[model samples]
Target: MRGPDPWAAPPPPAPGGATGLGGAGSGPGAGRPVSWGREILAGAVVMAAVAAAVGPVLGLLWERLAPRVRLLVGGDALYLENPESQQAIAGDGTFLLLGLGVGLAAGVGVFLLRRRSGVAETAGLALGAGLGAVLAWRLGELLEPDRDEIRELARRLGDGAVIDAPLELNALGALIGPAFGALLAHFLCMALWGPRDPVRRPPVFPRWG
Candidate 1:
């Protein structure tokens, strides 16, 4: 005769049950993430991209606003050179504004994408600022390689002459613009949207006699 049914109903789902097929959520993030390094790197890249794109525009703005004389007088050519004083003022103002604007935009973008601010956002803001500053510095260097020539021209030409295409980068802009911009963006985001929730701490109890 056949033995009794030892198999009963279904077997229990072992220990931790069945794992997912693929390595979903295998990488850095999701509820207490650990992708700080990666996020920082990505932020740097983003800043670099923004700087590169904006550099050309900054140069263009400087050129447009740079003061110039329409006509060359009898001896004006003797001291004709690019606009120095005006260029300095205009370029500095423009750089600061643009840097701040870019940072603010970046902050908005990050805020929209993420549910809350965290290490990634903070890192991105700080590192991105540094990168932007470096880029602004480089833009001036790369775009204006004939500084000596311009200086020489200025020395030879007479006063009142003008250089139609003058270009320069204000040192202060590269130094302070990015940092200020990043700070502003961070402040705005935090003030308006608030930062991510911090890790909760355990409650402490008092000792009893």
Candidate 2:
């Protein structure tokens, strides 16, 4: 025999023997129970990263579209009140939508990757949204209003006139964005991938045992 005929099909794997692919351990789906902690951590980290990246840009846009007062200061320059408040309101509203979109995408991804929805993933989505919103709000806090305009309004109105819109996160937005995002994501996941699998416990008594 020429070295067992090179390139010839090897002997068929013995029944129940290691199939040269996997026997007791080794395969794509082979793994321990899913690590919920890891999943939550990963999701939170990703959401935070995205929020951090967008916070400054959102803050700038919000500031530009900031609300204004209807009256004039001393009959001269426009006297705007609560630029901070206006900016926060606008930012919060705008970013809430953004956060929702992100959540939807995330939820869809989780459903597809896992081939089903589960409580762990639902929690993960909520956790991620919360963390992301917090991070974005924190970053947006760095924005400032037009100091020149503030000083001018103050000088003309003899102090305590113009309401300065301080730089900060929109409180309502921060609170609602994460909640809405997580819920939306959960809904999307359920709509797309169906509900989670019900747990199967061992037979009550003895079946064939």
Candidate 3:
């Protein structure tokens, strides 16, 4: 019967054109993968902005409250403030801001590097927090011994200051305060800003003539 009509209009072209049956299209169920780098970068940017806004406000608040808080927190070894001490504290604040900025930049860099790999936003934040904390802690320690007030207090407390004593505890608190502050700042940023997702493009193929 005419060689079975050869192609026969492809059996009426199965509904939905090329997307039907053996068509090349991925169809409704198919989806592209999300990029991780973009998400982390977005998280970092959010954190950075938050830090920038909050740092000065917190610094001011801390400065106002430092004296009273030091009495309770430092016990017998309160970090006394004078012109030099104030200058050192100011330097410590500056160092903290620097740490925050560095943390933000690092977070963004990590996100950029790992965007395509589906990096976890929490992990990235945690890393940033940890790094910031460590940096701030080191900065605080560096500033601590340089403070003439603290040096005087240390001298008064004697070189054999017992670890179990309030003086030692106060010193420990001083060492740890900046680290804790950095952690708080990082956590606040994470809370206020949601993670970001990377933009992706759909796959394309050359059309055949």
Candidate 4:
């Protein structure tokens, strides 16, 4: 057998200590330096922006899905076509449903995007979700038939005529749906599968015993 060639490259150093391949340690990232403060702030800002941008989609969905009340024009005023109709309530419910769904989606998205989540990031998620919900609420209302237009329609239609009422969110409290949903989802994810000790990790290389 010939001796090793002079120029041959040496073998790579083994991963573990002499104790053999050590149990899983902090992988290759343990030694790298990280600016956690900056990272957390940046992550929060990014999440907020992304979450806020989704507001329009929520608004559009709310507008399309919300129920409109039916009104009857009689004499000098209009009255509900059916006084007991739940359409008004349904509008608020629709907005709430949409908000919750959007919030859940946002939470899952943030969790997936930030595998190692930070407090600032979580806060940002909530803040963004709240803002998004507000935006959606306002935008949805704006998309509905304007009060002036509805009145004009009622006037033009004259007495004994029925018209679709503008969609309205009677429950202002429904706005919390998005924020509550986001927080709940985020909490669940963190509790169920997040790292046991996010701030701690084993060393990348095992120490010789």
Candidate 5:
């Protein structure tokens, strides 16, 4: 055999390539883990914040669209101008309709922006809808005439006086409108055209004699 060569290059790697840890094909990002909880929490917070921002606008709309109830101040007591008037019920109906429309719009917007809807988004929408509705309720009340101020005005106007009352929401149950509408829209979209993974199957062949 020839004498060993001190400067000979190392042998080439195997054809199958490296198979052990730290191999040539290995990479840091190959199996990195994901923190889904954090992702969900962050996503929920962002969605809720965005939804809540619409409260002021909703309040303004409610104030404009809700029917006003007329009051007749008499002998330190107030009474409805028309006992048969449906203005009170109509006020609740207006709020409900407005809430439903807003919630549906929100749901469609969210779905369009994030086609991959998940639990985080759904929870956020429901929570945000309730919060926004509450905010709108309070804001709408504030925008209208104050009850105390009205009472004072009634005192000045004296008995047999008629004045328009502040816009108010009487049916507590109507608050559910936004949440119901949002969920409805979301489920409808999901049922109609949501994405699904393709199923894979082996091909079949018929035998011939």
Candidate 6:
């Protein structure tokens, strides 16, 4: 018998375009295409936009509703005045823009840290919003109209001796507004553009394995 043909023609290609290197269609070289970085950037941008738009809307609504409820429940005696002169600060278009800028910055930061997907983004946004709200609240308290003025106003409305408590409520409002703004923005982005998954990837090579 002739020596086994050392170089017999390679077996015919498999039907349906299969390759022998890794068994059936497409060898180990084949891989799913991906654009992880781009997707992350896009996700961040969308999240930021969501945060900015929703924040102001929620803030204004809250302001309006809170006062109304206070008036209704407290009757004539219960009153909360919003002494802030800048309506924008109270959830106007300018504040919305500010919120947007802040949100974008947060998103960019998150993206840079490689926390740009799934629940990571959500968590990042939430953390950022909380911090931002706290900062805003403190700043508002610092810049608030003099406590004496509030005391005078309370005195003018008096049913009794006016107790001039430190403006704790004012500070609270300031803090709450930014927090709400951030939350709303985050929610909107998640609803409209957040990643489908919230879980992160497992590391390659199982620790047990």
User: What are the TM-scores, per candidate, against the unseen true structure?
Assistant: 0.52, 0.47, 0.32, 0.74, 0.75, 0.32
Q: How far is 193's C-alpha from truth in model 1 (Å)?
A: 2.7
lDDT top scorer: 4
How much is 71 displaced in model 6, in angstroms? 13
Per-model CA lDDT versus the true structure: 0.53, 0.53, 0.42, 0.78, 0.77, 0.45
Model 6 per-residue lDDT at 115: 33
For 73-128, candidate 4 gives per-residue lDDT tens digits of 99779999999998989989988888888888778777887767777778888888
Looking at model 5, the pairs that clash are: none
lDDT of 5 by residue, 74-184 (tens): 989999999999998999999899989887877776677767667777778777877788888899999987889999999999999999998888897877877777778
Top TM-score hit: 5
* Clash totals for all candidate models: 5, 2, 3, 0, 0, 3
Question: Across residues 24-58, which tens digit of lDDT does each residue of candidate 2 receive?
Answer: 32333334567778776666654554444344444
lDDT of 3 by residue, 1-209 (tens): 12444434544543444333433432432344456667768657544543443334433433333322122114445443332334434444554454455445544444444342223454444444554444444433443334466546655666444221111112223333433444454455544553533334453333433
Model 6, C-alpha of 10: deviation from truth (Å): 14
Tens digits of per-residue lDDT, candidate 6, 63-103, equal 33221111111222533333343332334343334544555
Q: Is candidate 4 or candidate 5 better by TM-score?
A: 5
| Ordered list by TM-score, greatest first | 5, 4, 1, 2, 6, 3
- How do the residues 57-165 of candidate 1 rate in per-residue lDDT, one tens digit apiece? 4444444454433223234243323334354466666666666665566556555655355565566565666565666556655655364676566556656655533
Task: Count steric clashes of candidate 2.
Answer: 2
> Between candidates 1 and 5, which one is better according to TM-score?
5
Model 3 TM-score (2 dp): 0.32
